[model samples]
Target: MATPTIKALSAVIFALSSNAMATELRIDNVKLYQPAEQMFSAPTSIYIEHGNIVKLLPSTHKQKVADHVIDAKGQFAVAGLMDLHVHLGSSGSNYTNFQYLPVEAHFNANLYLGVTDIVDLFSFDNVLTEAKQLQQTQTSPNLFYAGTLFTNPGGHGTQFGGKAYVINQDSDIEALWQQHLATNPHVTKAVIESFGGMGNTLTDTQLAELGKRSKAANLPYFVHVSTLADGKRAIKAGASALAHGINGEDIDAEFIELMLSHNVTYIPTLAVYHNHASESEHQQISHQTELLPVLHKKLQGCLFDKVPEPNVWFKTMWQKRAHAYQNIVKLHKAGVTIATGSDAGNPYTLHGIGLHNEIDALAMAGLANGEIINAATINGATTLAVDDKQGQLAQGYKANFILLNENPLQNINALHHINAVYKEGVKINREQLAERNQIIQPVGQECNANITSQTAQAVIDNFNDKNQWLTVSDSAMGGGSATELVLKDKVLTVKTSLGKPTHFGAWAGTEIRFKQPNDASNFDGVALTYKGSKAPFTLSIYHSEVQDWDHFSKMLPASEDWTTVKVPFSEFKQFGFGNKVQWSAKSITGLNFVWRSMPGTPPPVPNNEFHLKSIGYF
Candidate 1:
């Protein structure tokens, strides 16, 4: 058993002698969790100074004079919990306002739930940079970020539009390594998606090279996997950890052994599936109103509508969830390290409170109360490679902890009953923390809405006019591809080629800029005359009301000759690429034609072509 390392024995004498410094903060009459003993000690008085635990005295010890003191009144005290997998800015629409997300709101939510530290698996560089500064204020939880993700062209990470380092060939490795070194991220992330074909995956050589670079840099290499095969491939490629548990399959002994031998920690975010499997369960756990004035409006909205209406995929995931739960139990019994991760901010997984749901799910999966506590606390720190600095209650550990109204040792759900939270030895006011999020007026006056750009309805051109067409490609954002419009012999040709390689995907295409924003309600759909090889290309119509990229995409039916395609607006499913919520026939922006790699298709390779004649809507 490991013992707590005493950090300041001199503080004990200062505390008992009535000479405690004005900077000291003390908590009295608290039953504290002793990690080495794996049990709670009798009521003790703890003295803290300079954000570190300084001394522990018996319950009978006289209260020393201190600048600040909290009477625990026999309440249970435990080391602050750590969320191993979290995304303050995530892969969904919530990120549409990521830049505007009130930092106070984000931090308060975690503090209120007793999660004093978070390992942000993925975030834009700017967001991570800003967060690094915010965590130093002694109010917010400590943040550790992977900074950016290196993914296959058009792989899962690219769809979110976060900072993605694209790796298309083995030669791209050196540049990626340099980029990782420049950022100095806490971990290096790579994606191995299961829904797509092998093209979307990194070759074994690539994964191994990433591992090599990460090891050379002394950074942990964490891989995101979805299926059993993806997990196996990632591990074989030298991944240090599995970002998520494999779904849709049982954990065989061989696989368990593989994980054990590699010393990989499994962060099974079961709460992600719980939201898909049962809405009522989400409703039961989504106690956002309890958070009161500080809860962000967006999070409040999520509380009300936790998940999309259950679809066929939901039903399928529900069945697979059972298999996943059993596999987790097997891994735990085999002495494999399992940590609690909610994948918060995904859909129904709310930050802070959602982690409690994860703990409950782990409990149901056969983890004892002590094991669940360890997973959330020490094990979580271990997973993020920060165990030495955070996660345990001991001398030398940062004085970040939570006082609970009930004993979590008796019932894991007692974690939800937070009495108070402390960061750096200072108690946080939940109400004041929420109040700081309120906004006042801006420095400038009103009338900002009058600014407008060159937005108008487009006039259809039949390839007879050269100025009517403009070409756009992924090259603008580090993608390799060029599409050009050529007019010869009274024919308009769209010539495209895979340029170098892209972080997103490689493709070139053209769009007809609308003269002014048009109302989609005035028209039913679009009709276009296009001719190309049997290969497919994407046709998207853009609208302005979206928060992010607001557009609807459809694959052009396979064709080898000229074909007239008419698609109704109803057939188009809106995505984050264009607009957010205002998805009505109210405002339409423009249209795009591109041959590129989408989410579930083959990886974007080097050759594709298309030609267009006219575009119009009836």
Candidate 2:
């Protein structure tokens, strides 16, 4: 076994000193799940020491002395659940205000819902680093991540702030691969989606080269494919798993044969699709789970009143739900390995509860409870290449399991009736987790008071309120740009370094997100008091109606001295492929103040600074 990190050792020390855990513990009289038999074993006793399961014997075996003993009273014990696909940084909502939950909250939520391990398919580098560091001392679910995804420029993976490495025919594949490897990612993921020709896609050659690099590094290669052709191509190129179900067509015998031959695991992520297709306002499990009140309200509000005319992307996803569901059923019947993934950070899927919703979707697709259990357990571990140490309740494996009030094999819903959750032989305090949830609301102010007052000028952010802001740059897209935001004495300062521009150019800045839409339609424009560099800056406005990164933006003239700038709503122009529509500031979600260096421009001095005394709708 690998040596534990110092943080892990410290956690053990704290648990022992606080009497939260015993040095040697035994759980008795439990119906333990036996993965080999796909059934519950007779009454059994599990002995755990040093955070690993040491023995699993019949309950009638000679009683062994231990530091502590738990009488389970025949409760069913199964391997803690795993979510193979997740984005840890996102709060599971597309709305800007609802997307800023602290990363720890996501970890706690997963543990609260009995998910012991999660694979973040795509995440920002900072988030991945923080999560891995926190795992050592914190009681978070074990995290495995693909730091940045691979995709073409302006591809599906490039959206939502360009959290991917975009490549082209002339790009240095080896250099890009090396940079990605530097992150020490456990798995490598690439996107092969075209969104029905509405977006760019990575070429077959690009896909094959990525596969070769991943194989050479001994990393599992997972691909996001949407159509039958894309799925077959991914498997042919040495894909270890399909990140999503094929949604463009029916699964045929040929595709099944290809998947079987390649041994490529399939993660349908059916819950994301089901959530988009259904008109329901909320998932019953979400309400039962511990969610911050603000988050719960936003989630419900976003899903409650269906839009009369959904955008093309939204309509497309909704129409593909049936195809995705049918494909999962067909693939399962063909003996393809189906793993559970909630794609939780998407529109309506919440983290901890999202996995349960995925299991429920699988049941609706005709999978037996036993099959769903395997999918959520061993199958997920196999997909992540960690089967030897996780995904089972067997002796010698890590003592991570969930004790439930009833037998999950008898009824799928029994999985939700969790009596206790254990990680590395330490029992988690669910009540304390609940209390944390109550206080851990989303970090931003809502414009509820002035939302309906037509004459009231909405304050987007004053830099003095209890609102959270983020500093973002093009480094996420492989550019060298960097940015930082500091607030002090009621003033916000933005420092930026516009690195040499890539094919996509360079941008660095700061943004403030709202918890709910701010009705700025009553105002004519945005005005901000600022001072600093004479370099040009841009003010970008994000709204609910525009879902993509092409938020409407207006250029601001250079201000070498302290000055106030006012940008009219009519001056904002769409920066990308989004439809050209009249500016409607009724549901403004966020705003960004950015410095851009267009392609071919001489790299500017690395030092650039600006200050914002205040910003609001005027």
Candidate 3:
């Protein structure tokens, strides 16, 4: 565990002690983890009066002065959580209005989940400002938010009503950003939706210019980009954080390095996606869980009517919302910043209760209770710029805490054991929260059977290797010939025994050519494995139909040893290049690996050695 910085400590202390003039109440006998940098454990006492921490003293000092005293009695009291990507003021409409989300209820919702501060990056965001003011006038949750997502003309979130989701390319986006700041949403939310969901639509120059302006304006510019070209483009654009993991893109080392270099923080809304899709169609929903009953009831009352009666939007929403937490384990181990957020307000997924599901998903994602808690707590605060106050338990932080009958850190499901919730100095008993918790508990059998990290890894690994394949293309005639892969002195390698593209045209006449077919069978794909000479080599695939150069072609990563990789089915194209696709075989048999997108077209006897190897289908 990395130590929290001194700056983080100072921020928490500042937030706690800021309201020094408030009344005083002492809370003692709790184990505190002020994760701002240090670990303090003792019979610590917090002196909070009127919604703010007045001082942190030893329990012995509690007798000196205080209006009310709460005996923590060894309860694990940590700072409140911060949810950066929350959907506030929600309904069935593309936008949610604050009218439906009352201040009292909204504040109570945060208190229920131990989330003291929040950032509602949605339409009708003025409510956040009001909430902040309410915190001063009336007791409410500390809230900060972004007005709305700025996007391109007909870009990503066009149907999302409320504020303008579609920013016509012709309109001045910077001007719109300026207008947003004027409204005081705190942060400026921007969109870099991939063009046609194939490539990042934003240009580097545009990003640099926008980045400069956002920095100058002293606003953190958060981007909502997904997979393939869009993700590649936006990360290269220098972003503060990526709203989602490479949603439509495959996870690879190169992309990971890019994110690391840019220091891009990731808020993987895995629940939003996985809540719908799973290993099999039957596994998509928790068909056996007790949550189904609660979820069904919640769905009944939710803007279920808001979804079109005949539309398959709900179905489609789940289908597209497929994700595996394998990436979380990978990133966590890789030292990537992974935070928490529930992309709620969609369907079935609601606010308040939605976060618990997110926590559940984290457990399924293989994150330990400690990591998951920190991700949702401290890490979340960092994402929302509220770490100074929330996300820890210390002397000066706000007195937003929860007491559960069971330790959620031990079993994430224990999150349901909510015993008590405190907002500032007032205690809202668990009963108040349960009536609206909407969280379904597992009954007789745990539909939500706890699958530990070991099991999850095995499942994920098996899923990756399912339906594997090795696609071989037609070799252009010329001198290009094909042969079986061989191991030269124990080192497995491939040699281009026969063919070479003299010019960049088709295999001389096409008769001797082999190919990769773009057909339904080829979709939902498989992986290709081949050993390369060494690193620093380029493996490229191309087709004439690939009009967009950036997205036109794809490349295979260079690996030292023979490696198997899974390629998503959507990558194949209707390009007029490869001539031989032998589907009749029903399987890749005796297929000759042809062609290598050569690096400098010079020698290696021009288009050097190419080898053929086994391909796994998944």
Predicted candidate 3 versus true structure: per-residue lDDT over 519-607, tens digit per residue: 22333444565555432233223321222221122344556666776665355332323222222212211212234433124333222
Per-candidate TM-score against the hidden true structure: 0.74, 0.71, 0.57
Question: Highest TM-score, which number?
Answer: 1
Q: Mind sharing the TM-score for model 2?
A: 0.71
Error at 617, model 3, angstroms: 50
Model 2, span 352-442: residue lDDT tens: 8788889888887888888999999999898888899889998889999999878888898888778899999999998787667656766
**What ordering of candidates by TM-score runs from best to worst?**
1, 2, 3
Predicted model with the maximum lDDT? 2
Residue 5's lDDT within candidate 3 is 100
Q: Which segments of model 3 are wrong by more than 4 Å?
A: 1-23, 34-43, 57-64, 92-107, 125-138, 165-171, 195-200, 276-323, 429-618
- lDDT winner, 1 or 3: 1
**lDDT per residue, candidate 1, 489-600, as tens digits?**
5457777776644344456787876666666576678888777744677788776554345467777775677788888878877653322454555566677887776433
Residue-pair clashes per candidate? 17, 0, 43
